[model samples]
Target: MAILVLSVLVLLLSLYFRLKKRQKNDGLNKFPEGPSHPLLGHLPLMTSTTDVIDVSMQLIRNHGKTVKIRIGPKILPMRTSLLTADSHLTEFILSGNKILKKTENYQFLKHWLRKGLLISDGDYWKRHRKILTPAFHLEVLKEFVQVFESVGDVLIEKLRRCEGTPSCDLHPFVTLCTLDVICETAMGTKMNVQSGKNSHYVQSVKKTCRIIIERSMSTLKLTDTTFWLCRDFYTLKNELKVLHDFTHNVINSKKNNKSIDKNTKRLAFLDLLLKFSQDENILSTDEIREEVDTFMFAGHDTTASGICFTLYCLADHPEVQKQALQEQKDLFGDEKNPVITYPDLQNMKYLEQVIKESCRLYPPVPIIGRYTTEDTEFDGCLIPKYTNIMLFIYGLHRDPDYFPEPEKFKPERFDNFDGSLSYTYIPFSAGSRSCIGQKFAMLEMKSIISKIVRHFEIKPTSPRHEVKLSAETVLKSLNGIKVTLKKRP
Candidate 1:
């Protein structure tokens, strides 16, 4: 009798779920239409990694500017929102508005990220942003130029060692270059991961991203009990535990050591954060760790991806390469080149255009996700609450309307526009959530490109070395991006 009762109850609950799910889909027809599947809803559309950006673009193309997508079970009520390339809607979402909140998918990041700026929302995000903004200021970045120059020179020498090689994987080199910068700039310590054996830190960072991307692809259907019981999840937990121990020990060592003067000439980001930790008006020690970790994650890979794309663009487009080379010659000709001054970088408008163009073609973070907290209307379509919203910058950048001949590599498009369409060409994103390190990132990219183009001419070993992109948090090549680096006289 007891078994019979439980079976009937389970059947009743399943029936209720099917009915509720049907109602949600029926409601979506009243708004913009999107591809849907029974039981799965629009979940199947984004299952593949390669076409996620393309899929988003297709949605926009099929359903106009604003579209509604149903994701997961209807009982969850998480509606996926896409705002197309509508500038007003873009501004609205990124403006840090109260009504539009980060979705619950971000909750998954809390496992690794905690309350860092990237994961925080509302008051916590604002408070941290205020305290952290000072570190990336113009004056502070100016101090890092010497370090940038030194690193650039070292990297050039490293590439010189590979001079005769017909082809090389440039991605690893770019990753090393940026890793060196972040270690110096963020940690005040130098860990040259570029040419040397991979450090524990570098490997750990890559591993974490790979796992996170893999986990993101699957549906989080396991119950807490099931997860606790699972062996695979246990292994993941232990790996993360190791990473946590490593980061914590590094922070603790720096804190306890009194050998280095607080007034040391090198104002590394770690030093700055340490200073903040001491001040009464600033962040607590726990907060300091979160912010430092945030910078550590943010500083390296995104910039590396940007630089890699820039080099690929230059190598692929000879005319653009020629133009960039001329610009470097005109700006800093002859004389085994002085370090790129802030002024020199600022003046290299054409190089800036080239980087922007590369970013358009290959954005580092191809998709930025947000979750809606409340029911919202976007372009006359009802976006139900808890939806995962994806702003597909990759698709938007490639849209023919915004960028004609979008597939062609052309830096000149930026030359015609007077930098007004910042939101339109948001390689670093725009509005309140704009990358805090934009100024620093630009300086590093410009300085590196200036040094590189001036010294060597890059080319592909085979024009047939098909360029491809994959995502492990940041978009990168499936295999490393290999190309020929020819020495220039």
Candidate 2:
């Protein structure tokens, strides 16, 4: 029976490749090709190695800014994607309305996130985007500054335990803090994840993120039917249940208690959704949960990763850290715990540059994907319709043409920076479909990092820890982001 199953798989693969060969003859091979196996294409090349980013970088180095990467056997609609680091091409894709549909790469999130803004396209995306736009407006995000301060206080207290230690991993501590921040800001419920209260929910989120990335990288687990055969399928099922249940309970609780806090006038993302649902009839309960869950997923991990990378950059570059700390001193005048306000966060121009430079080196979301709905002509090449376009943001940020000495951590490069670079420096992305929470993220990051610098002197480990980059859903280090923290005198 096993032998019969193996034979059937072999026959199917052979037939699939045969059809792929015929389809490729139909003038679809317009882009420059990379090294790939005829049958498996780039799937084996990408999955065979642990460092997917390195493989992608190597491909770009060998094939210039744009390289054709085939990952599967589908050919009529085409499973072959164009991997590009070109800013001009990126602008063409990101700035256009026709290529707004996200590629199948993001489909793994559907089971967890549903049709939230991150995955939804066309009219549904438009409606939800319109409805949710106000939640992250400057005014609404200003309300979140208090949340950032309170949550950042917890992070500082937690990191105090690691103070004076030889070395500590900052990723886990920062991740929990961001999770807590997102829980409070997105759901208006204090999760206290940093205080070690909601272990199950936190673990479920971590597990779900890991499982989704694992499934996305595996060719066999791309489809639901085949995914069921993998062990992670069951794990993902249980984790999603926990995540969905937690979000649903929060939504229900918020619905039951509709009284707004009179003192602070703080409205969470969930609160705004509920208001829209009641006042404007814009969102249903399930839709509310969908957007809430999307915020929870998108909000926490990306910011946490960004913060960790920035901290790592600061640790490695002491002069930059010293200058950043001096800027903090200038802002707060040696007040250990100064009340950080919106204007203060805006005044953190140098710290903002540090964050941008860190993001340039290690963008939380290293790559974004878009699908071409129709045959598109750009740079004299005709890309076939329904082709997946992988925008390699990491490679784009490091391109020498756009950024001279791109590998160095030089924050001052952003000094007096106009918008001359266009799409080349898009750490938060660009265009209409750009990150909605970008301003919130920037403010939160500025608030948290500023408080951290004011309270602690961060330094690199004695051996100099280096992060082994992994191209997960969010960029993570295989080795933890390690640094030593000393309480400022």
Q: Write candidate 1's Cα lDDT for 364-395 as tens digits.
A: 98777677777777556565665666676787
Choose the strongest candidate by lDDT: 2
Worst 10 residues of 1 by lDDT: 221-230
lDDT of each: 0.75, 0.88
RMSD of each: 3.3, 4.0
Q: Compose the digit string of candidate 2's lDDT tens values, residues 205-314.
A: 98998888877777678789899999999999999999999999988987887576523478888988888788888799989999999999999989999999999999
True-vs-predicted CA distance for residue 205, candidate 2, Å: 0.3
Error of 2 at 149 (Å): 0.6
- Model 2: residue 462 alpha-carbon error in angstroms: 1.6
